[model samples]
Target chain A: MELTIERATKLQTKPNWSDLTFGTTFTDHMFVMDYEVGKGWYDARIMPYQDLPLSPAAVVLHYGQTVFEGLKAYKDDAEEIFLFRPDENMKRMNDSCERLCMPTFDGQFVIEAMKQLIEIEQDWVPEVDGMALYIRPVMYATEAHLGVSPSKQYRFIILLSPVGSYYAEGINPVKIAVESQFVRAVKGGTGAAKTAGNYAAALKAQEVAEKEGYSQVLWLDGREQKYIEEVGAMNVFFKIDGKIVTPELNGSILPGITRKSVLQLLRHWEMDVEERRLSIDELLEAAKNGTLEEAFGTGTAAVISPIGELFYKGEKTVINNNEIGPVAKKIYDTITGIQSGDVEDPFGWRVQVI
Target chain B: MELTIERATKLQTKPNWSDLTFGTTFTDHMFVMDYEVGKGWYDARIMPYQDLPLSPAAVVLHYGQTVFEGLKAYKDDAEEIFLFRPDENMKRMNDSCERLCMPTFDGQFVIEAMKQLIEIEQDWVPEVDGMALYIRPVMYATEAHLGVSPSKQYRFIILLSPVGSYYAEGINPVKIAVESQFVRAVKGGTGAAKTAGNYAAALKAQEVAEKEGYSQVLWLDGREQKYIEEVGAMNVFFKIDGKIVTPELNGSILPGITRKSVLQLLRHWEMDVEERRLSIDELLEAAKNGTLEEAFGTGTAAVISPIGELFYKGEKTVINNNEIGPVAKKIYDTITGIQSGDVEDPFGWRVQVI
Candidate 1:
């Protein structure tokens, strides 16, 4: 795959890394590829990150025909840049593309393009604990058509933002509101895929939770609003009787990469991992009886965010009294170590960028 | 609200209304408004229909923090423009805005701006058999932030597209594929809101149905996947044993205005309109034994589309054999007549623009 590079017209000098916010500051360059019905995906390139002039009738702006994937690049003690299981992200992106009717590109081509862009913005990758470059690959329908059907032309673009630790307090647990009134994903929906609509749909509940002083909203199954699905943007897991329990691979819950990795690590550590239909009643009962040792959410940004308390049905149930559980701490350490290359990666999940 | 009207820099001289697809053709002007956190929504104007220059880091392009409402302006026999329940559409738009964490605007302000735009593009309203000027009111996060939090800045836009008759062949019934694999909206999600994400999530399944030789996919309820929820962009209803049955207003289904109007019309006609949960299995049983009289989808664009056949699990269930049912014909006639000013709108739904 040939690449065409274009440097930004302007670049920041002496960029401040101390107060950098996640997703606010972006790198100077962005990777782009075009897809058309007759020619398929082509014209892959890394160009200067700038404003895109879009027709008023573009499908994405109107119909929300967009999908995106998020992963991060870590700078290790050896001063090397590495991406953790980028191919997995690429594969998941393809899955999302198929669901959104977007043209899929080769995973290797995207990975290579990402590495090139990371190399160009290597200096922007902050060298701080829990700080790394967050890579975002977005595919959108760019065709200037107003039809409700899928677009014939599309654009795949990648951007990078150096994000600090998602939680400012660093692994300190958070209060999550169990929203029985609102469900995030329904069965046979686009909840499993990393589509734009899933996130957009959750913003309202998130806003309500934030107003109530909660970090995120824990969504239940849409039909009955009883089964535990996910927490806003992350997949959820529970620890009952020292057994790792997560919701089954229902079409509604996103099959997160970090979630998969955590399950593998638990299995490798000889801990029993059970993927089943986890219900809210079961979790509440377990927590009340002290059988639930821990509860956490997993995603690319936050490896594991411990759930301190759950507000559900007008009742506040403190799972662990706003403290991070041991299992959560252990998983966080193991995953962060693997990502930073401080520990031996037995599964070979990391791919070196430079 | 002070208005700024800018005529289009260029217009399609030879307008092709004959080959006008659904949303492909646009008028010469559009309505726009801006909203910032501190100042609220302001700067309402009618601007030239042109490209929207968006920053690379706009939040709508990433998080899908957007919502929209659809209505239409119809030209009567006297060449007068009339809007059907535009205030209802405005209220629904703000309801969606609240769900999406977007700033709300006054209904009158939006209506006033829309009236100006309609006056500018009054000629675009087709005078053919079943044609109207489609109005799309959209609100999205325009902040240049990368965080997943609610945006402090937003853009509310109104676009006009002159659409031809939804059914070119005079409203022939359609075939629907029962999608047991994909779900559109979940409880506690943005299912009730007219949000962009919900539509984005349905594109893939809609494509699959088309490939399977169906016009649309019938979405089942998220939890059970047994209950009928909706069809692509439309609320569904079935006539079973002289009763009009539709899914109950759980938090997951959009409160379609057309759906509400139809139910009212049915009730006015002395038909029993029951807004309750209708199971797919029950419908199938009814279809097998001839209890199912007719099935149709209701939305803004396609006022009512009769379902000719239902394909579920590799079985074909014909509904009235491609003939529009008696109840459906009445609904189609009453709604289109009121919209075209051929009948009196007793509910005070019509708002004349010119």
Candidate 2:
């Protein structure tokens, strides 16, 4: 588990904390490892953030054999950094790697490397209440070939970016367009894996939604385009008649880490929760019947993005009068509180890195 | 569309023609261009073959917003080079770019650039009877951002590889597995585009088929898994009861240039060809009745590959007595003859580069 270290000779000036943006400014260093077919994973090192010299014929650039994971490092008032459910992200990353046919590594070793990386760049963790250092771990096929197969060479990298809140409006409920035109992923596709292709498949629909004045798109099942799958890059949840309901992980929905935590928190509080096939028709009916109490999206970027409006087939459904519902607010507060070390850790989900 | 040229100072030794492989060796130079949101496509140049310096957060690596086109440059006995329907490849590449939200350029300009690139490395074009220089043009998002949206910057690159026949066995019929479990693309998915994600999604199935002693997989439709869509990155055609049949372009199958050329050639030869849905059940039924005369796959890489046998659900269907059928042989010979200047170019599909 020994890691090589290389310090930067010159460091760039950090961005103003008040004006930080997502994924734009990065820390001084990054962690990297490479894997060859016969050599396995080797050359683990934490070096200064630099451009990767890649072949023009690299498989990742041509076939999209890449996977990534996203999580954030939080700093509380005590100035200690914590990672929320990083082990879960590591496990999910391995799952994504397996789906993409890339090599998998020991999650614990990688987590330890991430901890060292975070320790060295501790100052980059923003002090703002809602802001944290965004950590991105990515793996891609590096084989310089044109064949449509798994790569024999691979590279895994971890980069850190100083960030602001995901939503520019700061957790205000967002308008979502229920997309029925473009399908994201099918049942037998790579949807369940956090692979690059699923996100690429989603860009067009997201663009259309944004053009229509919606912040994100609500994706339905690829087969029928009827059942709700996810909202944008997050797992979606709806509160109907005092019960929390989310679409079950049916091999096409990404098993989000935040979604898992929210469900756990709800179950711990003894709330009625159900994970099942939730259809858009049923949701619209509930909205019409005044039983759709709350709706929100959960992800690493935006812990809980309350959905204020849903546009489906030229019809709009306003939920909770365009306000954050009580349930969403509670879930958001409890999760963020635990992440920032302000609230008691009942679930013990937070891992201290620094 | 003026393209600047930069010659390489040192070139690597060319691989022996006898030992040539697919997509591994490279030429002395490559074509490259860049695109910015408002600046449009610019900086077109032919430069020495070298590694591309990419950022860790490049959108293509994380989101898979990449597309590519494959064509080949053939050398005739008279020392002249020809490109088979390269204009079609350019047009399809633009279609792919539009689908991925990347900027599209004039097809003519890109084709001219490709020609110049080919002329610069004309010696790299193999003179072997079955060998040619494989040309690959790729476009990918280069914007270093973490959000799941279209990239504001992109890179378009073209690299050349001198290779032998796609099948090391020299166009011999090979075994294929009918995949019912894993789906490649659906109607609303990115199946029609020569994008990176679609190929990424097909790798697992291809791997499984390879493990089952098959060279490729016959992918069915994503929804029902009933109808045939494609075969191992190629458009498939079947000769059922002496009629040439292929899956229609229903937005879920890549409109292969080789496939189109073959259809036109068949029509010119006064053969009955139909573009319609051909289900596996019907194909198996035809096999049982001894009406399935031939089955072949068409693509840029493998111009025509004969399917010797199909394994589906533990049942094997041997086509044309596990040999290259008459129709497939004629089609392959006609196409290759036209490409290599051994046959009349009545279809005007050949573009003379030098």
Candidate 3:
């Protein structure tokens, strides 16, 4: 796929990298492509970052037929830009499109286009200690119709935002509330796909958790509300009785690349890890027995977010005495080290963009 | 509550009334308003029908933080426009907004604004049998942020489209497929809200039903998948053993305006109507016992769609000899007649716009 580039006549001054927030300040350019029913993906171009002109009757606005992917581009000490596991994100994005009845494109071709777009806006990659250029790729139905069917027309766009560290103060552990109501996804639902509706369905529960003095929600299974599914937008893990356990992908949990890497790293170091159904009762029992060693969440945004406390049914259990455990610290350091090119990448996860 | 009117300088030629499809052609003007956290709802205006300029990172694009309402404006023999219970739609739209954590607006003020918009585009209300101007009111988050929270900025816009009859050939019965796998809405989900995500979640199942030679899918309960919840986007009704029965106002079913009208009409005529849980097994048993008289769906678009045949788990049950039953025909005529000003609306359900 050949990509045409158009430079912007003017550019906005970059913000202070250290004081930046996530997904607010954008770069100078964006990449866009369109898809029609008869014609596949066409007219891939890089243009000035601007507002999109859309009809009020667009299918995406009324039916939520849209999917998105999030990743980051980091700059090493030598000013080289690199992307961590973008191919995995692309593949997952296709999975989301299939669930939403939207068309999918070649992942390799889009990854190549993403690389070209990142090269053009490489200056936007922050050079701070924990800051990086957050990349957002979105695909939505642009058909100007009101029917409840798959849209015949689609638009795929890539945007770049310079983001600060997820935890500005440091990698502090957060408190999570165990949600007993308002499920995010079910077995036959669009839970595994990173679609907009899944996130939309999660906002209400998240709001309730926030009002109750919690940072995120620990979602239970939709049917029984017994098994632990996910924690806010991340995959959760618990170290109980010297065994690392995470919930199996039961068609309702997002398959996080960071979660996969964490598991791989654990196994590489000869640690016992198991992926199966982990019930909330079992976890609370382990906490009561004082065998729950460590609990953390893994995702692209914050590589490792330690869960210091869990509040369920008016009961709060503090984990690791409200501090980051040794296992979480090591995993965070290893992942961040590999990402910044400070540690040896034995897994070949990072791909250089420039 | 003041609405500023800005007429289009150049209006496009109106499409042929007979050639129009639902929500495909727009009028010359549209209604728009904005909402801010502290400012409330303001900047109400009627301007030329045009494209909306949206940011690439708009909250509605990434997260499904949007709600919408669908109603219609009818034209009588005097060329006057009428709206069928628009106040109820505005009220329900507010309910949907509350569920999605979006702000609510005054229903009376929006109803007045809708009236003004409809009056300005009175010519767009087609003067044909079973044809009217479809009104779409949508509210969505406009904040350009990636965080999972309610947006501080929102846009509420109303667009009008002249639509042909839902049954262009005639008011014929349609076959429906019982969906035993995919669930539409669970008890704590957003099924009661007229939100975009709910509709997006049903598209895949609808596609599968269509491919199986069915007009729509009859959704069962999300938890047990035993009791019937809804049919496509409409609330369903059944006449069994000389009783008119429809599903109760469960949390996972849309409380359709037309469904309400149908119940009221049945009560007015002294018919035995019941709003309670009707299980699929009970319905199939009634069919087997030759006590199932009629089955139909109620909504704003089709008004009343009779169910001729139901396919469930590889078994087919034909109803009323695969034709429009007497009770369904009467209900459809009564609702359509009341809407078109041909019958007396004793319940004061019609609102005159002009």
Candidate 4:
């Protein structure tokens, strides 16, 4: 495949990385490709990050025919930039495209494009503790048609943003509200795909969670609303009776990369890990009996967010001393270390960007 | 509430009404309003049809936090342009905004803004047979944030498109495909909201249906996958034993305006219209026993798309002589007549735009 790179005419000099916030700032350039009906994805290039000249009838503007993926780039003390298991994000994005009826792109081609974009925008990567360059690859329907059908033409673009830690005040435990009225994903829904619609559906519930003084919403199963599915943007795992118990991938919850890595590391360390449908009753009972020692959420951004208290309706349940559990801290540290190139990547997960 | 109106600086000559197509061409002016965290919604105006300056990190770009509502403006022989049940669209749009976490605008406010926009672009309203001005009201998260939480800002805009009948030749029977592997909406999800995510999620399965030589996909229940939910973009209705039977509003199916109107009409006609869970087995049984008289889909774009053949897995079922069914024609005629001011507004559904 041939590629073209057009540098931005104007580039930011001496970016104030210390004042960076998540997704507020962007680099000078971006990656874009177009896909037509008969022709597949073509005209792939890296160009200046600017506004897209979209038609008023673009499918994404009306039908929300779009999908996206999120990953991060970490810089080590040795001045090396590495991406943690970016291939997972690439594969997940393709999966999302497939579910959304958008054409899928080659994982390797997408990875190569990301590597080039990251290399060009390396200066924008923040150099603070737990701060990294947030990479977003998006696929959208660009066709100027009004029909309720899949878009024939699509646009694929990758943008980069530098940001601080997810919580900003270090990895502190967060209070979460369980919204019984609103549900995130259903069994046969697009929950497994990292599609935009899934996140969009959760926003109102997140508002309710925030109004209740919680950081996120703990989403339950759509059917019975009795089983714990996941947190807002992360996967839930519980340490119960010396065994790692996490909700199985039942087609409604996103299989987080961090969740997978932790499971792998735990299995490699010969720890008990079980993936099954975990119910709220079982968890509360375990917590009451002292079998549930720690509960946390894992994802690309937060790494691991400890659960201090879960506000189920109006009642609150405290968990494991209301602090970052030792297990979660160890996993978070190991994953960050490997991504930042401080520790040896035994799984060969990190890919060098520059 | 205070209101501000900026008239369009540029206007175009009206196009031929007979040449209108669904969502192809827009009117001269559009309504736009911006929102920020503390300031709320501001800069409301009716400006010329143009592109919006959106940042690359806009929440809708990545997370799909968008929702939209569709209605039409009809011009009677007296040159009166009226909107059909716009308050329904307004309520649905706000419901969608609540679901997508976009800022909300009042029903009367949006209706008034749309009235002004349509008034400015009134020349674009089509006078030809089965042609009208298609109005699209969209709300999205405009915040330049990449976080998964609810956005602190939003943008609401309404665009107008002059459209002809969906099927210019006439309402012909359409072949349908049953999507067993894919589902449209799930219980406790955003299926009821007029949000963009639900439509985005349905595109893939609809594409598969089209590829299989079907006009639309007949969505099934997300959990059981045995019950009938809806068609590609419209609400499905079945007539059995001289009674209209449609799927109940189960939080997973879009509660369409046309569907509600059909129900009201049926009830007013002293005909039984049942809204309950409908199973595929029941439909197949009815089809086999010659009891399933007809089937059709209802929406604003496609008033009634009659279903002739339903391809389920490998089995096929033919419905009602493969023609526009009597019930469908009656519902369509009544609804269209009321909309176009040809019949008495018994329900007071039509609201004059100008």
Candidate 5:
């Protein structure tokens, strides 16, 4: 029930943030905890990041009983780091564990531990204009069994990586291909849960879209293949006739944190917004009628990613003449500004760690 | 590539045959190989079975980019081991790789390496009447990056487990519940592939069924939730009006190896069999008309698991007076007989080792 810290013997020299690839570099220390069925979670420790000595038959390797969360820590000009809505991420992680039949941990306890970790690794935070310290929390089954049931043992780990800017270049609109061959998730599947198998099942579709010269794939509903589900790993929004429109939180779609923030901001500003089922046919028709004004994706990694073109079933529809629209740009600037402590924290979403 | 063998300095004590669990007990050695993007698969070796040193950011531990296969090695009275349909398992493993966007390997080469592993762990095979050694072949992404895409590195492993007899208390009919809430898989999803996420997704439903006094949960179609899909990870079969019927391979159903063998055996014996769409309504109607005869599930773990009762929304249907039928008995006996070399294997499915 007590947290312990064991420092590394030696630290490696830090690399230039601009030249580093996204999520490939890490800090010196990581937080780890173990859990058993009757024993609950215990032995919390901050240790040096190194190879994990796992059993050859660990359940996560063969059964995919794993869950993960992604967020970032941004530094203001005065050298203080803030994490946005860390509580929401922890709650969502518990939801994922319940869906996967795993155990749940205390949210406040983990947030406090994360703060301790951030305080120790304060110097690792990037000073670059667009970069941040990426936080990755992962929990997986460590039971060395070949049975296809819920595991009795588990390991929870929180890793820190000094990531490069998601938009190294300017925030340009990207080309997306509407996928009809593969479905990302179904209503009765693990789509709403941030588990590993959903992403693994989507790699083939993404690979095919990449080969066809598309930046990402826009998935439709698995049952009907009509309603829009997600664009790549992020939630999508479309502006039609000066109204912001996004798909509702159905069972098959992930509830993105950025997507929720955008909705809250839109409602606070008294802007027109609609959350309902938006089909691909309806979207394409709106484009033909000149009502489809803007399109973009929202997620933690990029914050806001504009969509310049969409190709589906041998049909092409360009939006806003292949440029970032005013609404999208405004939302991006506001959200990022709030994260870096440059704007008013009306919602009080950001929590200072150091 | 050539396979190098590194024997362990101190061998582990062989576990008691009857006391060992199904898959927790393992032999002394294992086979491993590596794969990278530019370079093909290399560094094949048969080494001691121990802990696997893995990176904290390995793609498989987080993203679930993994595939696997299962089979058993049976020993006859003459001290010779028989591997039934190893080639089929190897080919299916490659199919699983293609579906998950992972790299494929030489099936023949892996099979040969497995034979060598079996030879080295010959003494570990159980001599019990129904006991055998289970072979698990697993492939998973090993790249140490946090990107949600296809990994650049992977590892393939083969492990042998000395398992106890599944029918230690004699084969008994199991009660199954028809699941309407949580569907196992949907069409155009990763249902057909032997991937880990699919199993992880089904655990919640299985756990609920077990608590309600059911041995397994029978899955329905995701789109309509009417037609039958699978029964607790195994393919299902029904006997109505003297005809053997099963759900067709409609992309959402796993192409089970044991299911194929059953169909072949039924056809070889000139029995009536049908592979088509079978809705739950039609099946329930058959049960009401006093024509429903038998039902069973097929898989590598249990060659033929008979179903005695089926539970649906406030309705219960009993089959064959809650007993195994004549046809089900014949199929199980024939399959087990062929596997143990007591009956003629006309299909040449049994490959010899040692």
Candidate 6:
């Protein structure tokens, strides 16, 4: 539990905060720890961000044995910083580690480590309206072997990237295409885990969707290809018959932290919210019958991505006249407000780091 | 493709050939190539085997945008090195690239590069009866951006390892457990691709099966969990009522090179062989009636692995009295013979590299 600190002699010039893109720039330092079967996790330190020297036979390169988590640190107008539900992210990362056969750590310990990292990089956090410092915590197998088994050595790293909008069209409704040819995960697969392989398997579908004039692809279940699962990298929600509905976590869907917060916030606000299996047929029928009110995607990157149009089976359905719905706007405003300390934190989800 | 060559001044001591394990040892030289979005694949070179410097934000480290292929080079009594169907491995690697959204290379050109690499490292190939040099060709995203998309930069590397046995009990009957709880892949997932993500997802189940006294786990279809998909990382086959049967290519199973060669060789011998869906219930029923004669798995690593026992649903069925079946023995001997140049070259598979 001893954490060593190293100060960089010289820091690189920071990027222009006003014209920031997603995940392209890094802060001055990074948090790192090494794990060996006999030595355990040691050498916890924050050093200058530099290149990682790995063997050609590292398991993470050849076998994809990696798990990652994403969260954000926001700066209020008064220059105070807060993290939105980072505990949930670390807990979920452990679940992902268990699923992917990687090692896990105490969630609280990692959260404290992350707090120190953010505090050191406090200058990187933007005080703008819709911007924050994105925190990426990743653990990967570093064993220099090509065997098809779990690694005996690992490396845990935490990186900080100052980002603006996740997508190019920031805070705007995005067009989505329902994908039937490719699947993200199956019931017995690694869908529930926020691991590297799940995202790697999704690139082809996402590329195709982008080429077809859609911002993201809506994934269907692998078993039937009839039920909704996720939208691109986000958890999807639908407003049907004046009630909020989303796909239940059926061992194959990612349990998004933002999706959970949205549900909790909706319920706390006395809105009708339910987690159950909803078929594509039912949703499309609701859209045809004027019962589909709004549809949006929730994740740490975008927070609330209002899905304006859904194109499935060569047909397009526009939701809420291709405009942002009141529910989505309110959810985004409330969550972002809480993160910036502008609104009351009734759920205690925000962690004031500094 | 202009290739560059860099020789090492001091060579590292090679491992003992007789005491070799899979993918643990490396040769003196490795083939490498780089790819950029607009520059295409360039900088093809054979350099000293060294550590690969990568950024923490490399897409392969976080999102698993990687694809790899495995083959072997054998040296006969005259120290003549030969490669078996390397073209197929490169072609399949391209297919895997398409599935994982990675950049593809000219299979023929890559094969030529591999031949040159083997020539330069000819002294490293093991000259034993049961041992040879294992060749690993892997390509991964090298872009230091954190976005969940196809990387703009990549690195393809070819590594050689002197090895002996792929499994601990080499050439012996291996006990396998039928896994119904955790599935490997479905029709629409990355099941057919030789990518890192698929292997990462299978480790958990493999670890569980190994702890339960089985060498590997037999994966069923991810959708129904009924029909058998694969045994461990290899393709499975069964002899029932004097006919050879294997699960058909349903898009969720890897099309193993050895499995294809086995089918072709069986047909050349005028044996009754078929590829179709075979359910576990039917297999167990046959075992109950004494008609399930023999079962085996096939892959490049093991060549032909005889399955002596199958454990499923609290039931254990011994195949062929827990011994290497006659058919499996013949196929293994034939394939290994062709690879070593001891047998007649009917399929024109073996390519002399040195």
Model 6: per-residue lDDT, tens digit, B1-354? 898989988898877777777888899999999999999999999999999899999999999999999999999998899999999998899999999888889998888899999999998988877678899999999998998889999999999998885544556798999998898999888999999989999999999999999999999999899999999999999999999999999999999999999999999999999899999999999999999999999999889999999999899999999988889999988999898888987998998898
Tens digits of per-residue lDDT for model 4, A173-212: 9898877888888876788988788888887788877887
Model 4 C-alpha lDDT per residue in residues B1-354, reported as the tens digit of each score: 555666666667777666665676877678888888889888887777777776667788778878888999999989999999999988888877776767777789889888888887788888876888888888777677887777787878898989876678878899999888877787777889887788887877777778889988899987788999998888999999888999999888888998988999999999988999999999999999999999999999878889999998699898998988888898888999998999898999999877
lDDT-superior candidate, 1 or 4: 1
Candidate 2: fraction of native contacts reproduced: 0.82
Higher-lDDT candidate of 4 and 6: 6
Whole-structure CA lDDT of model 4: 0.84
- lDDT of each residue in A212-317, candidate 2, tens digit only: 8999999999889999999999999999999999999998899999999999999999999999999999999999999999999999888999999999988999
Model 1: CA > 4 A from native:
A166-170, A319-322
* Chain B TM-score against the true chain B, each candidate: 0.98, 0.98, 0.99, 0.97, 0.99, 0.98
Q: CA lDDT of A133 in candidate 4?
A: 89
Worst 10 residues of 2 chain B by lDDT: B163-172
Candidate 2 is scored at a TM of 0.98
lDDT of 6 by residue, A139-217 (tens): 9999989889999999999999999855445567989999999999999899999999999989989999999999899
Per-residue lDDT, model 2, residue A243, is: 97
* Tens digits of lDDT, candidate 1, B1-354: 688887777876636667878877788889988889998878888888888877767788778888787899999999998999999899988888888777888899789889989998888888876889999888888888877778889988899989988777788899999998877776667878887777777887888899889989998877778888898789999999888999888878999999999988988888888999888999999998888999999999999989999999989999987799999999999999999999889888899999
Residue-level lDDT for A338 in candidate 6: 92
Interface RMSD of each: 1.5, 0.8, 1.0, 1.7, 0.8, 0.7
lDDT of 1: 0.86
Can you give the TM-score per candidate against the true fold?
Answer: 0.95, 0.98, 0.98, 0.93, 0.99, 0.98
Cα deviation of A247, candidate 5, in Å: 1.2
- Candidate 4 accuracy as TM-score: 0.93
Docking class of 5: high
Worst 10 residues of 4 chain B by lDDT: B1-10
Worst 10 residues of 1 chain B by lDDT: B9-18
Clashing pairs in 3: none
Candidate 1 vs 3: which has more lDDT: 3
Q: Between 4 and 5, whose DockQ is larger?
A: 5
lDDT of 5 by residue, A94-149 (tens): 99999999999998999989988988888888977678999999999999899888
